[model samples]
Target: MTRFAVVAMMAVALVGCGGDGGDQSQEAAPEADAAPAPGTVTIVEPADGAELDAGPVIFVMETEGVEIVSAGNMDPGTGHHHLIVDADVDWTLPIPNDPGVHYHMGLAQTEFTVEDLTPGEHRIIAVVADGVHIPLDPPVADTITVVVR
Candidate 1:
């Protein structure tokens, strides 16, 4: 498997580990006996308004049953994460999973690898979407700002 695929698989494993048991499909039914709780999203790294250096790929998140439904453009009520660099980008657009400008973790994992950022001020925001890859109505997370030196 390719390096990216390996990383992706590992991410999926981690996410699945936290799952409460259901089919592999992101569209899987919430659980028969338990009603699906209102999911939440949060950035675990580079906290809100953090400063970072350019080099290692940083991990961002949208927690709460987060899944990546598309490598580009997050589907509504679905899955995924987008890394915005140098500017404010919309989380609702169908941005491709280009490793250069954007890292798309489609329904595979919540973990992100943010490597090779240019020296300057940049912002990273993570959003959690539902099964269709759309951002949650209220948006699962807040935009995190970071400075890369």
Candidate 2:
């Protein structure tokens, strides 16, 4: 046989040997049917309905399925925390930056301190919001009531 014929035959054989004798469809693998868990936020320091001494209250927050990032980081699945104290949130708007009511943790801080809480029951909420201080959709937040003596 000529060298050209031999080379052609070798190439054909190599191509034929590259696949199994079964179906040769190039379909992609099926994606997983399970969906991702929803994001959430929780208060980690004080248990709900707990009474404590009156002083600087330290609030610690935790998040799941989302990362805590500084303000202006509009990346998906990342945001900072907001501590809303004794005030209702207007979910349609961005979280307020007013102190003692809406405390914005724009620095990505997981914990914050509020001093001189009056001797009474107070409602505390930990909310996760985007870089622009807007609360997350479906509102990833946790609320707890605490009493100060």
Against the unseen true structure, what C-alpha lDDT does each candidate score? Answer: 0.60, 0.81
Clashes of each: 20, 0
Residue pairs in clash, model 2: none
Candidate 1, residue 121: how far the Cα is off, in Å: 1.2
Q: List where candidate 2 sits over 4 angstroms from the true fold.
A: 1-34
Model 2 per-residue lDDT tens digits across residues 28-112: 2234664564567888888899898989988887676778889999998778899888999887699977887999889888888
26-121: candidate 1 lDDT, tens digit per residue: 544567767655455667777766677668856656445544455454444455565555444455755444666655566456577776777776
Assess candidate 2 and give its TM-score to the true structure. 0.76
Whose TM-score is greatest here? 2
Residue range with the least summed lDDT across 10 consecutive positions in model 2: 20-29
| Model 2 accuracy (lDDT, Cα) | 0.81
